[model samples]
Target: MIIELKSLDEIDPCEFAYYANDPNINTYLRNSFPAPYTLDHALSFITHSLQHHALDFAIVVDGKCVGCVGVTFQKDIFLKNAEIGYWLNSQYWGKGIMSQVIKMLCSYLFSNYTIHKICADVFAENKASCIVLEKNGFIQEGYRREHIYKDGCYHDLILYALWRNSDEY
Candidate 1:
């Protein structure tokens, strides 16, 4: 399968809405990603993407927005680091798409920015994500026990990071 990461403007709002609304997909992500994701939310996201000059991208598969990925660069003393985020359609699960997407994004971020680290904090229950990050050369830096409270309970957060000058990067 061919997967291309494109800027937000290059993606269709309708297609974006179609993919962003998945409950399973939203389960592991932050609460900001609404469960009943609507056209309005997609439009709002598009607007933010346009205005923020965000590192975000729409994961395009054959011209359709099947997933999304991005990074948030830190400020001040942490300017050399960024946090990575991503999600794929449930229908595309177990297809090895996200690993490649993560690799591609990491490569771009390391190449284009002066970032020294790219990281992600995955819910401890998410075994697949932890494995994927490990496969991509992200080391387990720390574990925050019960670092988050969501979906009506507490959840641990696993911190994973990749260094810019490392062989992995």
Candidate 2:
């Protein structure tokens, strides 16, 4: 599978909106992404992504987008770190595709950007995500209780990180 960084215009916003709108897909995501997501929301998100200095890409497989992954750089004391975010279509779950994409992105970021640490947050109930992080050598840093209120209840968030100079597992 080949991974490439793409601009918003390079992707189909409608397809992305449909994937995000799926209830099962948004269940573990942050509150900023509303359920029943629409094309307008996706358009807005694309606009924001383009404006920001973040590295965002549509995860393409066999020339079709199955998901997206991005690195959002934080300011101030977190300047040397980037928060990674990603999502895949439910149909592609358990296929190890995301693991490959994430590993590729992490390597690319370390080489191309000034980021020293890559961080990610997984919902406490999402064991699959936790496994993925572990498989990629991301160490569990901490857990924040009731950090995010999603799907009508507060959810704990597990923080994980991988350093650029760490040994590859």
Give me the candidate number with maximum TM-score. Answer: 1
For candidate 1, what is the TM-score?
A: 0.97
Per-residue lDDT, model 2, residue 121, is: 91
lDDT tens digits by residue: candidate 1, 119-150: 89999999888988988999999999999999
What shift in Å separates residue 67 of candidate 1 from its native position after superposition? 0.6
Please name the candidate that would achieve the greatest lDDT relative to the true structure: 1
lDDT of 1 at 135: 85
Count of clashing residue pairs in every prediction: 0, 0
The lDDT of model 2 is 0.83
The C-alpha stretches of model 2 lying farther than 4 A from their native spots are 1-5
The TM-scores of all predictions, comma-separated, are 0.97, 0.90
Scored by lDDT, model 1 comes in at 0.89
